[model samples]
Target: MGGGEPGLGSAEVVQQPEQADAGSPAAGRLGLEPLPYVVGEDGAKQPVPGALSIFLRSGTAAAMCLDSLAAAQPGAPPFLRIPKEKLLADIQLQGAISDFHPIKDAIRAADCDALAVRPNLDDAYGDGNNYEVACSRAAAEAWQAVEEWRRAAAAEAEAAASAAAAQAALPKSKRRRAPQPWVDQGTEAEMEAVAGPPPRPPALLVLERPLRDLVASRQRHQRAQQQQQQPPQDQGKPASTQPQQQQQQQQQQQQQRAPRLVDVDASDLWSSAQSECRPFKDPNYDTRRARREAGAQAVPRLAEKGVQV
Candidate 1:
């Protein structure tokens, strides 16, 4: 390269005297060759002072420009460092004193616009796709909670229906509840009824028992009234009854004279009746029951004079 004009893709290089000797090659060289550098996380090697650099007017002049920027924005880093693996990773950095606009304007004024290339923000954080995924996850969780509530409600309804069905399946006698009288009905009228109408009979026997007892009692009353109204007749035998009485007395004496027993055995009757009557014997009888006791050994015949018992 010539002395007055700079070489393409070369920065001002500070040479070491030990790197060159007088007789060897590159002995009188004075120009700068761009060094290899990686810039802005592109993962590709670039020439120093190239388009990817932050200050590329001239390495000699770039130092002066950096000093001016540091004085203007003292909170910024003193040096510009290019990342090697990811683009615009600095998107997460806070409170940056020097953003791209001022740096770009400064590079343009210095006639070195190639240095201030702006990186894309979309590429910095994966185009905001991670944010979309988080929103989708939140929406899915809400829908899942709603679905769970619906299922629980449905299960409760089904259980209630099953319980109702089981109750209905029981026998009517067990499951039936007592009837509630209507409020609008005549409660006072029913209470005041001295003889309420009979309930509808489910069967005839429910009505028949009281009817039979009433008929029997009425007949007995009529018979008692008739007996009370009639006067007792004289005790002297009537002419028509005298002969019948004589004949009946004569026949009874004849039967007594030759009484023929059929099913009556005195010995068997005595033993069986004594055993059966044993329970009726009072323990206190020997001491105190003699006066009050009826004649147990001698049974008084219950037949009236002319009637069989």
Candidate 2:
């Protein structure tokens, strides 16, 4: 018999007693009634056919009873009874008539030995029909599965708790702050203006030229250039006296030495070198505006080509 079909056998139908014993295993203990047939058209009941029918029904009953017991509800009656008659019938139907080996095999397959009803469980001397069953193999196995599931759930919960505790115990400085709704978000340009422009890169100094010679040469060139560029304010006036010329020369030397002492000469050299070395003006000085104009021009071309702009 297949394990899924909940039907009766075709050989012979066993007749149930007119009056069943109130505490007998023939009556369900798990508040369940045996479903031996299915409802068909016109409200007629049709008998399900197969030896597997009773086996499946008995297995289902065993499962339900175990589930109730596991719930451990307060003030609930203990589950100690099982349907033995159905299990026995299933075993007999599936077992071979001759050798007792088939019956043993069927009993093992149906798990009937563990699930069958026993009358004397609470009291060995008591009538078997009025007490809990002796062996509950199916229930034991079901409870084991439930226990495993509970252990897994408990482990997961413990891991989560540990993680939360670790996070809570972290220092305030190390903890991440959530975004504040009251904080104002300004435009990128405004934010950049507030932060100020980034510092410019340091000037590159060439080491090939001797420092003394480079400085002296540059100073002389600057002095000569300044003299040529200066307007002749006293072209018709007499030349300066020897003492005055000497004093003027001393003042110019002092001005040059003062800048070198304060370390301003290097910056001066950097500025002058950069301006003299690079003279070309950039064509796309306003890059963002240029990009906008290019995009605007492309729109007309795309429209002329029958493409969406």
User: Highest TM-score: which candidate?
Assistant: 2
**Clash pairs, model 2 backbone:** 7-48, 7-50, 7-53, 8-48, 8-50, 119-128
Candidate 1 weakest lDDT stretch, 10 residues:
127-136
For model 2, residues 109-205, the per-residue Cα lDDT tens digits are 5544344322122322222212222233543343344345444444655765776677789997776553333433565559558865446644544
> Where in model 1 is the C-alpha error above 4 Å?
1-136, 176-309
Model 1 agreement with the true structure over 42-87: per-residue lDDT tens digits: 3333222322223222332243244443343534332333321111
User: What TM-score goes with each of the models?
Assistant: 0.16, 0.24
Error of 1 at 222 (Å): 29
**Each prediction's whole-model lDDT (CA):** 0.35, 0.40
